[model samples]
Every structure is written in structure tokens, then in C-alpha cells.
Target: MGKIESLDFIELGNHPEKLVASSKQDLYTLCYPSEKMPVPSHYADFVRNDTVMLNNFRSFVAHRPFHWAWFLRLLKIRGLDESFLEVPGELSYSLQNPCIVAIPHFGLHMLVPHVLGHFIRQDSMVLATGNEEGEGVQDSIEKILPNDRTRFLKLPDRWILRKLMRGYQSSHYPVIYPDVTSSGDKRFRHLSFLETSIRVPLGVENLSRLCKCPVLPVAMTYHDDCYRLHLGPTLVYKEEGSIIFPLFSWIEELVHLYPDQWFGWNFLHEMIGEAKLLR
Candidate 1:
């Protein structure tokens, strides 16, 4: 026999799902009176609703379609260079190989990886949701933004994430989603955001520890018909054991600065119980 066989590594991530139906329409998922969020005094005059409950419910439904349509349009255009404007214009130097680019699932979240991967010319793999709902979103995104050195994988279970760590160990770039919530994982580090405690995935910290690499915390926003990305300082390993502290602080600042573009606004209150008080 004069034949040679080669094996390719299996990709564990999946593409992002298409924008799903509004969770607001699901009666069982609706917020209870006691659980409804509150409206801060500052925005009382601007918001038409008396409470954050009514306001959030309305905003959730209203924003759903637009976010989806925006994704669709971005896919159609496929203009990574013109679509995004990164802050600190000198961001290129800091984005080295073997780095973890952890971005918040803020407004224009998907675009974060797309633009970064294309611009930086790095091998990219975004962690996917893996479930039926998540697959739908992925289907929508991949239809437009596929095969540009940027790819998606199924949700990072312990095994899959470890594989990513192995590849990252050898200098492959894995764009991470630090804000995506999964079902009942105790490893998450709970931190306060917008005055409410939100659980953050320990992926960034764990990966950095495993590979001994720093993380690039990126925040993205959509405004005036364009996407803007702000690259914060890199998070190096520290004696404190949690790199998420500084990253969360920077995220809070972004959420505070652009309330509308924070993207998590739709279900954040539901996710965090203490979110009863709005910002």
C-alpha cells in the first residue's frame, strides 16, 4: 500500500443563529410584577413608560427586528473595512497572534469578530450557541459572513474550549464571547454591571491562564449608520486570580456611555435578579 492518510482537526463551534422570535411574546417568559425592573429618576421624563418594566418590554419588541435586519444588511454588504471604525487607530499593533479577543455581545456584536478577523488577517473562530435557537441565528450570519479566515464553532463546552486553548497555545486566534450566558455553569464570575450583578463567563481568564496569554476586551456599538469598536487595554495575568475585574469595569463604562447599543438591554433585567433597579 502506497497511500498516506491525513486527519483534520474537528471544529467544535457552530455559526450564530438568526435573530429569533421575540421572547416577549412567550407569556411564560414574561416578567412578573415584582420582578419588573425600575426606572431611574434621571430618565423618567424621557421614557414614555412609568416603570422600567413597561419601557423594557416595549423596547425589547421594538429592537428585535431592527437588530436582525441590521445583521442581514451587514451580511449583504460584506464590507468589513468600511463597516467598522476602531478606536485608538493604532489598535493593529496590540492584536497579536495567540491572543484571546473577548468581545461583549453588545450592539453589532457579530460584526465585532467579522471586522476584527478580516482587518487583522488572523484566523478567527467565534464560540457558537449550539442549540436550535442559536443555530438559527448562526444560519443567518454565516449565510453572509462566511469563509474570511473567520469561522464559528459550537458552544465551548469544557472539552471544546480546551481544544481551543490547545490551538491558542500554538498561536491561533480565538475570538471569544464573554457575555453570552449558558445554562447553569458555576464557573461564571458574578460581577455588578449597570448596578446589577451579572455573571461573566470565566473563558477569558481560563484561556489566558492555560495559554499564558493576555486578553483583548473589545466593546462594539452601532451609531449614525456605522459600527464603532473601542479596544480597551489588554488584560495581563495578575496575582488577584481574576482578570475579569478590569474587563468588567471597562464594559460597565461602555454600557453607561451607550445605553441603547449595549444590546444586553433586552433581557438583562431578566437575567440578573437584582436588575430590579434600572440605570
Candidate 2:
């Protein structure tokens, strides 16, 4: 982790350039594990293009402090309002129904559930891992959101799926990050993403079937000095046996448009191993 001079919102907002520069070395190390090691095949294109890669790294670096400051601000505020987000008018109506909100690991992703709770005006459950980082995010959510508005469920529990099913049955929308890498999970599919294939979990698809609800793809990105939440059309199980491909496909498009806003770029190597060409 790089040192951030201050966590103040205004300070972070004003020193974006400094923030990016300060973390340049650390970001390089994260992207390139070893000087002798070649870039991962899936992320080779981004690395090959110096300008795009630098922008992506800059976004990766600056997003953290900005997100932390935003989180701190949220803790002090009463709650969020429609003015805080830029949602499409038509999509506003779609949020009325309880559906699986499949969000990718993008900019300010940790804030998606809280933002959705504002729009849906209902309680929702967010699925998170039980790791240190996951617990930290869970703690942040607990502190920022009213206890009644949202619930955080850690992953890998046997009854987790049942819990999600019941939550959906009770009209509690389940928020999931579909782009996470699943280890030793047989229920996954490989789909083309960027320059390589990525293994996407079938959990979201299964949950959608069990709950008989559609999967709504959501992305929260930082653009033009504002945090915008973009929503995609509902993906119903009736249309396909699996929505993993289409769901990730939409995320792929967003990543291309906002490569710097995507946090997944940092873990691209773990998601899909170094390309054979690079090896």
C-alpha cells in the first residue's frame, strides 16, 4: 500500500495527480510481479499500450483514497439520496422489483449495495467473502448503513445459498459481485474476457433460478468528478441456461470504456494465469 497524505475528501479530490504519482512505483510492482516476468496474456494489450496502462494504473491508485474519503464522509452524513447517484431514468422503475444485482468489481464497488438501498428503499443482503478485506468492507457497511437497511453475509457457509433464497423470497434483493474468482468450485464456466478466458461462478445463475428472479447487472463508476451508477437490462433465466457470459460481457464493455475504473485489473493475473505466449 502507498502512503496517502490525507484521507480528507476535498484534499483527495484536489490532489488526484499527486495521489497517482505517489503510488506509481507500488502500482508498477502490483502489475508486474517481477521485472523478468512478462505481462499476463489477458492484460498484455493494456500493458503494451503505455498511455492506456498508465491511465488504468492512475485510476487504480487514486480510487482507493477517494473511496476511503467518500466512505468517511458517508459515515458522518445521515444517508444517501438520489442526488448522490446518476441512474438512468428508465432503470429507476426496474429497481422496484426484487432481483439479483450482479455488480462487477469496479470503481467504488463497495458502495453499490448502500446506493441501491437508497433507490429500492428496501432491505438488501450483500454477499461477501470472509477474508480480512471482506470483513473490513462488511464493517464499513455496517457502520455506514442503518442496520435495518442492509445485511452482509460472508461466503463459503453451507447455508449461504439457502439464506439468499429466503432473503429473495422475502423480497430482499441479493447483491453479488459476479467477477470474483472461485477456487475449487466445480460450478463455474469459462468465458472470453479481455485477452483471455475467465472462470465465472455459476452461483448468481443458480440463485436467480432458485429465487425465480432476473439478474440485473449494475456498475458504479467514477467519471467526470461524479460517482455514476449504471444499470443494464434484466437477464432472465428463461432467455438462457446461464447468464454468466452475457453478464460478464457487459462488464467487459464497461472495463474497455473505463479501464482505469476497474479494480479487477489489479488481480487479472490471479483470475487468469499468465498467457502461454508470455510464458
Candidate 3:
């Protein structure tokens, strides 16, 4: 949250419209129904270069085989202690002071869904994703939601999610994507700027202030033999703006640690441009 050295987004070389069109075409074909098309050229490149970084740990977390063992290992980290692992039990009691668990986005396409399934299965919990979950995403949620235990709810947009969170305490378990932006760089869609306001997604910070919840930084990365999930020290904001800088610093560290994991690289560049304009 300290003064960030500004980056110039406008200086980025303009990508040709034809290249953008081709990338989009390939991506669409890959996601289209009926035919499970070939992996998009762009994503194939990503997998080629970065899949090695994921290694076997990605497979384990992706499939979710030995989760208990994984959790136990995370608990053994010094200073993480008991209560950190106790959040599952804690959720049923008081969500007045909820926890903001920020996990990295690398294997997170898998990790987030797994974490949601894990909580709902064990605790009769209900979790929400995206602004408004589409039918497809909801179908994915249904496959995971337990019959006798947990309830699955989808809020397709932020407005509805906010309203539901206020009304239903169980809705407190929210999987938020704070980084949302339209990048002029079409190559990276669904990405957001990282540095516009020291910490972008100021809304999330505001929510933490209002909820008085502690922010827990979660990271899952390929390490040594397995994928490691590292939970950093808990963060709490004091009454007078004490938490923003620390929270911002924490996010910056996360960005540096897992730069490729962040889907918002292009968005961050856009925010850099906005920051310069305002100055």
C-alpha cells in the first residue's frame, strides 16, 4: 500500500485486431458445446510453458485425494497453530467476524471449487461463486453440493450476492473475485489492473473493514515433491486505517510470488494507465 512506482499501460504496443480475432475464435471453439475442441492456441502455450511448474501437486489438489493429509501438513507450519485450521467449525458459530481467505489463482480454478466442496460436505455449509453463477457453473456446483447436508446457492451478479449476504448468514461463505476489469489488451480477457489505487479492489478492503473480518492470505504452488498450500499470517485492521497498507503489501507479495497465477496481468497494466492519468 506504499507509494507504488507507476507503470505506463498506454505505452504497450497495440496488438493487431486480426490477432485478437483469431485468438478469440480459437478460444471460442475450444469452449463451444458438443465438440470438445482442441485447446486454444494461447492456452496451449500457457500449459506448455507453465504446466511443468504445476507438476504432480496440481494433479493431487485437482483431484482432491489426500486432502486431510494436506490440511494436517499446513497445520504443522509453525505459528499457524490450531485456530487457523479451526475456521471450518468456526463458520457455524459467528460469521460476524468472518475470514477473508485469499488463495492464489494458479491451480485455483481447481482449488477454489475443491475448497467449496470440502466445506459444504463436512459442515452443511453453502457457498457462492461469481457475481451470478451461470447454469453451467451451477451445474458444476450441484455435482458437489451434498443432498442431506449442504445447500447450493448462486448469485449471478455482485448486487444480488451483496443482498443475499446481508440477509442470510450462511451466505457469508463467499468466493469473491475482487479483480474485475475490461483490458484493452484483448489477449488477456477477464483481467484487472493491480496498482491503480495502491491496492485495487478497494471494495474488498472496505468490506473487510465493515465486517471486521481477518484477512488470511492463502497460496497453493508447486513445490519440491508436492503442491504446497501456504497460509500467511492473519491480518486485522485497526479502527484508524492501519490495515490497508499491510493488506496491500500482502497482495503485492502474492502478485510477485505467483505472477503468472494472476489472471489480471492486463488489468493491472490498465490501472497503471489510469493511475498516471489521475496524477
lDDT of 3 by residue, 158-240 (tens): 45435434523543444434444211112221222243342344444454566666655554544322444455556676764
The weakest ten consecutive residues by lDDT in model 3 span 4-13
- Candidate 3 all-Cα RMSD: 15.6
After TM-score superposition, what is the CA distance of residue 155 in candidate 3 from its true location, in Å? 6.5
Candidates' RMSD to native: 10.7, 6.9, 15.6
Model 2, clash count? Answer: 0
Superposed Cα RMSD, model 2: 6.9
lDDT winner between 2 and 3, please give it. Answer: 2
Better candidate by TM-score, 2 or 3: 2
Q: Each candidate's lDDT (Cα)?
A: 0.56, 0.63, 0.38
Candidate 2 backbone collisions, by pair:
none
| Predicted structure 1: lDDT | 0.56
Sort order, lDDT high to low: 2, 1, 3
The residue-by-residue lDDT of candidate 1 on 29-90, one tens digit each, is 22234334444433333344556544653453344345444444444454544543545575
Q: Which ten residues in a row have the lowest lDDT in candidate 2?
A: 26-35
